[model samples]
Target: MPFRTSGPAASRASLPSRAAGRLARTTWVDLVVAAAVLVLLYLTLRVGQGTTVRFSTSQSAKVDTDPARLPYDAARSLLRMFVALAASVVFTFVYAYTAARSRRLERILIPALDILQSVPVLGFLTVAVSGFIALFPGSMLGLECASIFAIFTSQAWNMTFGFYYSLTAMPRELDELSRSLRFTRWMRFWKVELPSGAISLVWNGMMSFGGGWFFLVASEAISVNNKDYALPGVGSYAGAAIADGDLGKVGWAILTMAVMVIGVNFLFWRPLTAWAEKFKNEQSEATEVQRSYVLDLLRRSHWPRLLGYVLRPVGRGLGRAARILGTDDRPLTHDPARQRTGDIAFAVVAGGLILWGLAGLAEYLHDTSGLGVFGEPLLLGLATLGRVLLLVAAATVVWVPIGVRIGFSPKLTRIAQPVIQVLASFPANFLFPLAVWFFLRTGLSIDVGGILLMALGAQWYILFNTIAGAMSIPTDLREAMDDLGVHGWQRWRRLILPGIFPSYVTGGITASGGAWNASIVAEVVTFGGTTLTATGLGAYIAQATAGGDFPRLIAGVAVMSLYVVALNRLLWRRLYRLAETRYTL
Candidate 1:
């Protein structure tokens, strides 16, 4: 038999089967749920439509750098990161879920998302600050919201991508089981698919959260109309210190960020990792199960039980609501002509809008800088592309082995999570001195320095994702390999590498995106009045940013986005197909 191409719908059952489409059970809980669902839908409709908030950022922002305020600053940054992370989760659920459900939407949405995430945090920050400040005139809430939104952009994309892949690449048997269960879409989502993707979501979410900290300076420090604004956070404090050329204050800020990152990992991510281990897709439980001290403590407490008891009614109500809503499993009529027509319409509208935006950009560039501006950035982009490819490949070589060891050992994972997260969350600006020192001492150019700087912030994407993938390999599969006398290189070749290939691809793509963004800051280095610039797209963007040349910035960003998306489509996608065919869980 010829090789088969398994599309997303081939292995997943978010669709209604004949039995489920016919009838479902009824109860008072169901009635109450139905009523609640109606109320929710009404509220959603009322809130879904846009309401304009006035945009203004005339208010001057400042940060106080008292060491006494370190705790407060750390708290603010942590709060923003977590809040943004929460929002990212909601966005991932809504955005990725919708895209996954509809092939028409997926075609447009996925590509758009690739472009969106490729936009640098600074690019987003520039536009968001003014709008958010205007929305909440005379209130600090605007600045806070702006910071949170910037962090959201940093954190959401990786998570959304991971979840989208997980949904589509679900195992064939599980998809069949879901359809056979007579599940309505809601039931399918909550009971089957959601649980299925839980591991990927949690792990990827953890990575995104860590990556958000990499852009803390960009998020917390703002500049508009030649005016500098700094939010009261560790990031802004560090930025201020760097500006003042005070290494002491910078060191203190690094300490604060490290504490915040490691503490959150212990309290939040480790516990989630331990909890999500139960959801692993395997017939036999792993011999070494992940454990977390925080989770163990919580389990040993009465608080969780009490809370569960208190929220039992709410849980029941939601379950009932899902049952009632899902009972209507009537499948939509599949009219090929109409479907094709709708797809064409969607493409036309989406393509027209994109082209319109591009045309506007081109017109602006033509008027101000001329279309010739694109030439340098394209050449610079190729330089950056080489660096990015090398970064991903090198990081993969370094992290994969370590990630495997960490993921396969429950104790080691629990211990390493905080340490790894702290390292990942460390901002590159704080380490500029080290890069500069090495460059000066070794006589290496900014080319090598660019790679070093890019790796500082982006390597964790590969490490954390590889760990997630390694942990998810089925226990039964391992045992089967062992029983078949598979060992050492053969075991790795046949099982380990293939099992983690999908996750590695996910990690590699996100890491590449992070590296591209990091390049803007990485390629152009300045510390102690010594500035070193690499000849790359990143250097062009950095110089444009410094000069406050909006046109150059736009061109650089556009070109950079094009490069990132091209890499994603041309390279990572083939690995995605391989994972789908050979290693899907």
Candidate 2:
């Protein structure tokens, strides 16, 4: 048999002859989902439009952080969130590329990333605020940037991890195709790696957006060492409410959050998901097309038309550039100029960081006490890191097996799916009262309280991803394993485990990041504040808020971000590499 080849035009075409059949099957499936989402959006938007919401007056102090601008604050917070999300995507792209292709680079990068991610949100707040404030002296822009950065801390890790997961878990066939073609790294990345990974990354982005909202109150409102810089945002308002124990305000806030989430899902995420599904290579015959009024309206609008016009030119330019850069199927001589440019960029960043470190050292020498405060947060971050690691590891072990088994059995998956969704949807705040009561009765430590909070927030990522991963395992693999007489432990160890490794990692990393958000609430509690605090990053943040210390809080957030970045670079990167090399089919 002679080798078969497609024409260049055919290769670049968006849809193939086989695609029509797949579309026929899937179009109706997504149409139904789109319709339901539209209905949900209508109800949420109608209910959320009014200024009046059910609230109690007894908790006025808690919700009074920016009493004069409640609605404005909420709007601002939402806008800032979008801004942070944009920044997060850019940052993720940069970091993912740096760590994915190069092993030697990854070794240094991953550990540093781990420390950044592990450090608490407060650690960053403490260090960054003064600097940001200094950058644009006497301007709200600096304050705004600080607040947005806080939101970024919550949102960025999950998105970055999503990209990382997609990059590492690329299908073996795709990897082989790229390798056989001898495609330049950029070509393989732009055409194959990115497109294949996009669905999962988009899904992660949607989830992370919601998760980011949950942390908005904590991130926007700064409290450190007894000094409070209550930025005008939803978070500051919510934090105030928590502090004052206002049930009505809390209820109102929760309602607002729900409405926003529902609206965002319908308007943005739902359509994107539906469209992304259309790109899948296979679809169940039973699947259907989705109908979306918003999308229908938008499809006829001028915006997409304008976007098409703009992007057409850019796409052409990029194509030409790729060719010029030697991204053809056959190998080409490496470009010394491009390599040198990259080296120069790296050198600049290194030099800038060195200067920053030197300046910090000089300042610390002037006031030894300043260095001592930073050390305190470092220790607190470490304690928090330990708590997060223990809980995340424990959750993974418990959830992976259960999720995989449920996934393998359709009936079980169907029965368990709704229950799992509900559990995951339940807010950590809902569990706090019970957690607090249980601890009070037992006179338990804050460390235990913090762990429980972190666990509750983080566990679902592992559970959900594991289920998705396991269910997505190719049917051919299942048959092959059965034919080989693989069963019980052997089947799981050899088949199920490897199949779901990517999902497990996705869950673990997201959960680890969620732990950071959960810590602030976990370590610092106020049920009329008989004022119990833990010896962790969360406690440090809570105490700082109480004491009104902003510098310490920023310091804490910095340490936390550093930890998270370091962890991903170290643990997550290693696991990703293992998956790509060892278990990949």
Candidate 3:
């Protein structure tokens, strides 16, 4: 048969048959998914209305052991994570873009970001809880909001750094091309800058999620002014179980968390990773695009086709609206006089505020304790710094090689990626009891145990970034090295280490900051009525917070922040500049 031979009658005749074929191809899975979605919507509504379960402040502090309740608890916890992730994304775009684009903003914003990143997750909770509680007095929603914000604090900073770094480090050719095209700031952001930064942003988002989990337990089981305000989630459940010394419940919580983390990676992050590869500026000749079965299934499904058809008009309308929103047409130009005046004014204002804040804090400390009180906290800061350096050094030695090996092999990466993500997401605090037991049994010092705990939380930053860097190495370069008979330590020293150095620096910076934050929890761990205290800034901060000694806590936090900012300025910033100029691939 000659198929359709271009006749109107022939096309009309084919329409019915095409429609019948489509109908015949509809599967049971689609129907099942539709039903499941409906049931989920119903459940969500019920949960929101507090009809199915009450997540009240009073009830949130208790631990429930009924296996059947685990699903609801898990759902509540995951909801907070998703909400916080959404907030983090919004924050990353605004904060990172603003800092990256404007040199004037960068001066203030970059330093502010560093300080914020160094501030402990617990510090955010302490500050946020009281305000949130006052805002929504005696309501569960306020507590939930505060918990989500705490998680946001944990997740936002590193993701912001990733985006800003990516934007600043964009290839010169791409920048020239965008300028040649005469792209407005908005157009350049949409068409060039955002796409260029997408891969790094996605990878960092995954890492941020892991950090969110690390703090979720503490955030959920919060105490403000010695008053417990536990929210109904797996975190609070685990915290209560640990407090009550219920090993069985702890095991169950661990299992549930494991399942949830694995499921999320498969359902969300895996697909995102595969999708973001298309946005890479330079695609290697032999680099295989990462694949996700979930993504493939969605592509092949009829639902996506129908949804796209339905949303096409809406998308076009939005595009029109975007174009109507005015973009800056003038080319960017430097105004030395204006810039200098702005800088001077900003410095004056900022210096005044800082001096005023410091004076207030000093007076407060003097009135309560004495000027000499800062001496102990400053000494503690040094002790914590030593532990951080040791842990970061050990972690880099162990994880970088393993990350490179896994990243260079696609088969290995596919097999190991999800597993590593799951491990990274596992809360380090959940294992505190086991760590304490080991320390007691071996008669190891609490200081060593605390360092190990901090390392467990922070080491993944190095490993994940190393893998990302390694995987990005061009295939042609690898092949060229192979043809030259490059192998073993020689290959690593010349090829891999240099290739991954920039990423290693990025990871190290974040990991160092994270270790500082992890210290607050790690330095003062109490497991099953056994307390282990390490004498450091983290311990000082934790003890002060626990005892409601606001003056001491503020002093400890101030000292810790000073150490972090100083180290970042004197060490990491210089390293980062070197990486930007010399080591970037």
Candidate 4:
């Protein structure tokens, strides 16, 4: 009636203007996000209620692998992962903050973290499950607590490392600027340090989440002391499928997991990456910025502002707590005597903790076994160590080049992001059958195949960290490299390696630890009742776990922890210092 355009050309020309005019900035997206979030909370709460229900041993062995239950099971498993993630974040912030602020603590905490990272989830599961079950007798909540803790151990260590690196490696210029501004420690932490490390935190948090997923089966389908504590989840569903030789159910689990992973990536991480772009400390805008529709919609909506208003009192409370805790009186004092006293006190406390732990461990070993308690496990650890080192080396050779290339091209990264995430998140157990098949078909030994399986589980750590490292290299520097005609090996030698070295150290350390843990899963493989065992510490640990042999599990875990700590202290620790001190941007 108003002579509106109806022809194809006119309609096409008017579409954008009409769409823009018709779009309500806050209405639709706000409603959608609110609805989705509320629904999710409801679902999580509904699933969590099952945690307090009565439990029985027979229930664990009778996981119904029906495809119909896959969605509910997936939701339950996802809830566990999220709860563990929340705990891991809390641990990372507190632990890394303490260690970063205290030199003495750093010296102790870093090595302790290395040892903790090397302790396999099964090791924790074996001990934690019994204690938790005793604490909450005849209830599913205890098993839930044990499972969440297992997932937390898998996630917390590398995240702490990332945050610690972030805090410890702030640019000199930023530190000086904060000094010039006479910033309080809390203000500096809030304004400069946290923002600087936010990117690393997000990326490493992503990696940690994937690691949780990689070991989800172990966490969800647990067996301690020959009592099946397997909870109702996709993990138990899949494990039961594998045991029953039902490839079809396994396929369903895979599909369900894929959908869940993809949904989370698109809805959560992609948006976070786009939001994090504002925190980048570059001289020029990135050549290609990350974009996510969810982020865009949120930015255009009024909900964030509304929510901030509603949460103001909570924010103030947190701010007051931060002010009290983050206050450092040390900087105001030039008294060397006071500093020395503090140092002495710190050392005494740390030494006492170490001694107490060692005494208990020694006593336990004494009580558990007679002779050569740790000797065979130590030797087996060396075998596993050989596999870890070799596989890490190989993964570096393969993934570094690929990761660098991917990182350099934002478009390629955008296209490949989900693919890489899925690949990393796919649990190693799913692929065990393939490895077992290869071994059966080719007559290759598990000793060699074990390395491959470990690489499969652990290599993503290297790749993801390398990609972050490459992306963080200043765009201005790359342009200068181009202007100076830097090409090929020289480009990599001069710009790439130095730029990525610090990140590579972080990645390599985490990757090696992941390989150490993966050995427990990889060294022992089963596909449809056909089992293969490799001669390594991982197999020793796995066998002990299956048989519910507590003393043997502890022995294997302790030796593995010692080997990992020694390797980190001797090799990776030195490399870490070199990179942090010499190769920073």
- Which candidate number maximizes TM-score? 4
By the TM-score metric, which is better: model 3 or model 4?
4
lDDT tens per residue, model 4, 313-344: 56567667766765453353468887789889
- lDDT tens digits, residue span 1-585, model 1: 885556666433422332243225334444554565598577544432211233235545556778998976776677678789989999999898878777878888888888887888777877787788778886667778888998999899999989988888877576667677776566677777888888889999988987889888878887644666677788888877776777888889988888788778887898998899888888987777877876876665444444555565575676677677543212334778877798899889989998998899889889998999888899989999999999999998999999988887888987888888888888888787777778999999998778988898788889988999988888899889989999889988999898889899899989999998888778877777778899898888877765678888888899999999999899988888888888886
Q: Give per-model TM-scores.
A: 0.86, 0.70, 0.89, 0.92
- Which of the two candidates, 1 or 4, achieves a greater TM-score against the reference? 4
| lDDT value, residue 335 of candidate 3 | 71
Kindly give the stretch of ten consecutive residues in candidate 2 with the minimal lDDT sum.
Answer: 51-60
**What TM-score, to 2 decimals, does candidate 3 have?**
0.89
CA lDDT for candidate 3: 0.81
In model 2, where do residues sit more than 4 Å from their true spots?
A: 1-76, 102-108, 131-141, 169-187, 224-227, 231-233, 278-310, 321-367, 370-386, 401-438, 441-444, 475-491, 541-574
lDDT at residue 130 of model 3 (Cα atoms): 80
What is the lDDT, from 0 to 100, of the residue 9 in candidate 3?
A: 78
Best by lDDT: 4
What lDDT would each prediction earn against the true structure?
0.81, 0.65, 0.81, 0.84
Clashing pairs in model 1, backbone N/Cα/C closer than 3 A: 54-134, 55-134, 56-134
Ranking by lDDT: 4, 3, 1, 2
In candidate 2, how many Å is residue 501 off?
A: 0.8
Clashes of each: 3, 71, 0, 0
